[model samples]
Target: MTETTMPAAPGAVPHRTLPAGALPHDWRAVDEGWGRRGPDFATLSEPSACREYVALHHALGVDHGDHLLDVACGAGLAVELAALRGATCAGVDASARLVDVARVRSPEADLRVGDMHDLPWPDATFTVVSSFRGVWGTTPGALDEIRRVLVPGGRLGLTVWGHVKASPGAWALAPFRLAAEPQVRNQAAMTSLGRPGVGEAVLEAAGFVDVRRVRIPFAWEFADPATYARALASTGPAFVAIQEVGEPAFLAAAERGATAHVRAGLPLRAEVDVTGFLARTAAAR
Candidate 1:
């Protein structure tokens, strides 16, 4: 497939150009933190993102004709789901362990352990691309790479945490506060794309057009507070907390945070606000 390029729209947000051989963030640390409990994340944490995956795929109109690539695909749940819908699916992630699980789950998928900022695929390879809360404000460079791998007018869909503190399930994220102040601050920066106008501006800057935002469903359900703690500990953010205060302390904090949300017989549910962005590569000129 031939790659296409379009002039930036007038008055669009200016894109930041990085110096040669520079990376936007520490992908190695990200890989280690996320891959620490790869199996646990696949079984426990990845399921919680099913709603976001389904919603975004639907929004992007993923179907049989599409060749899809899922960035930061974690354990490949999204890739597996897209394949079920008849799309030819591929995925890439920073974590080798998670990529292993993903490969097992979607044996037919072309899954790779690599950096999102520099995808291994050729230009104009995919018809649709997605990243569920994987691409963040700090990683705008990944959007450029995503565009590079997408065919002209190819669709892109991504999700990010939205107004988390205002969500009904805000307690679900309380355990992350156990991390050191520096990590907490970095977490805040990562989620900044979820803020109003932030993601759209960044997408536009990356030369994507028709950018729009939609609210997507995101919830975490656990059998009990202990289960909640275990699930929380499997994620990357929780790893930071676990490092600052040992895993035992972080687990205790998570359980305590979830205690209030427990019900008599129902699963403990934390339904947090998640924002989804849908955009398209500039059409052939």
Candidate 2:
């Protein structure tokens, strides 16, 4: 087994370097109601991650007893599945609120609130490392963290959000047409995915190899306009931002727009790009 540790931060820590930890920033504001929506994203996110897990298990010959680390493990989505699969699973995230929810949602996990740049564990601590729909790191810190923890021949499994050009993950917004102006105003307040392959290039820079990419095309379905509107409002970052612009009027309008779309019987399909990567360890001499 090869041992590794997250690389040192460029300048210096206010304190000494910590081991594998979660992100330093707070994320609870954006992720608080993550698992409470109509469809359990907790369940949706991981099974979707299963394809990559299977790839790693097949390519690297993973053992059920191998330790697995789920990065940015919101609401224990990947945590529960890892536990169910018989791996000794742990999760790390920047949001303590989400971590707490993850712990309650999947009591079987070893969840921690720490930064990917400063993981809490020692070297060669995990056999498999995985992350789901997480925000991009400002630096290549996560890759450094991953390399540090994985053993020789250790595998990496990541499910990344693919770039959408035309739709741009924007179909759900159509149902909320009434709320468009407000939503657009709301979206102005946050960070963004700058462009495509930004993450892919970062993964390469972090020293990962055998990077395989694929897209998972799926539809976000709703029983009706009201349900669809609520579902969107309940979980999405964009939807949340719109509420800041006086939600009462926008919500009412969105509801009517959504009802119109529902009656039109449009499929309302949007494609999501979920890419996976697999790699091994070297330079352990």
Candidate 3:
């Protein structure tokens, strides 16, 4: 948590501090994939997350006095929204390209490109923290880092895709199956936190208190199947599928999956379950 100024990437805002040592190999790989279509994600995919961001901020009571940090804050949409709600905001993501977009969106925010497992802020630097579908079952260690930067009794809000297979939007995500088998397995592990009682157990184990679940509103809407395919292709999961099957194959499969859901004049809509968790750091004794 000690502050050390580090050189910022080209087009990135000056970071508050840099994590010690080289970036983790796994995180670098993740950054490579997600940063592939950064602008497409910023313009097409990230807007759909507005409802989730507003809902979680409401649940956490974010306001003018709060200092907020958004972990894995893709393109800084959530951070921008928080700033509009009058909270001072900061964010971090592994993808430098995505972070560049975020810097443009929220010029004053303390946004950085860094690993979630090793946040660069000093201890107890934030009053609230949020991660929308960012932290996963496979990265529960990130929770320990989240806890480190929150002041006593500080709030935490997180979201994860919930009951995805049973949701109306399942079709929208079906193309992710084209990823190699190991990537598919990793996806399952990532979403495991959304299962019943799973997130609460993990939060408590990480020393968070008052853990509870809340339903978050989420949906994906596209003007047509082709647009849907374009948006999906911008996501990290889709990048994995693209790696295995190639971008053309992945886009074709996504378009085919969405075709049945298309309406003549209406946008193709997919409503998926999203689970939100609200918890707090233990109070100062």
Best by TM-score: 3
In the predicted model 1, the residue pairs found to clash are none
| Residue lDDT tens for model 2, 54-167 | 543345444588798877776675566666667888887655556776788688778887666666778899988876545344334667778889987677765544443354
Better of 1 and 3 by TM-score: 3
When summed lDDT is taken over every stretch of 10 residues in candidate 2, the lowest stretch is: 1-10
Off by over 4 Å in 1: 1-25
> Comparing 1 and 3 by lDDT, which wins?
3
Least accurate 10 contiguous residues by lDDT in model 1: 1-10
Per-residue lDDT of candidate 1, residues 182-230 (tens digit): 7787778888999989999999999999999999999988889998898
**Tens digits of per-residue lDDT for model 3 on 1-285?**
100011113232223443532355456655666777889888888888889899999999999999999998978999999999999999988788888889999999998878777788899999999999888887788898899999999999999989999998888888988988877887888888899999999999999999999999998888889988998888888877888999899999888889888778899899999999999999999
How far residue 21's Cα lies from its native spot in candidate 2, in Å, is 12
In angstroms, the error of model 3 at 9 is 20
Whole-model alpha-carbon lDDT for candidate 3: 0.84
Error of 3 at 163 (Å): 0.5
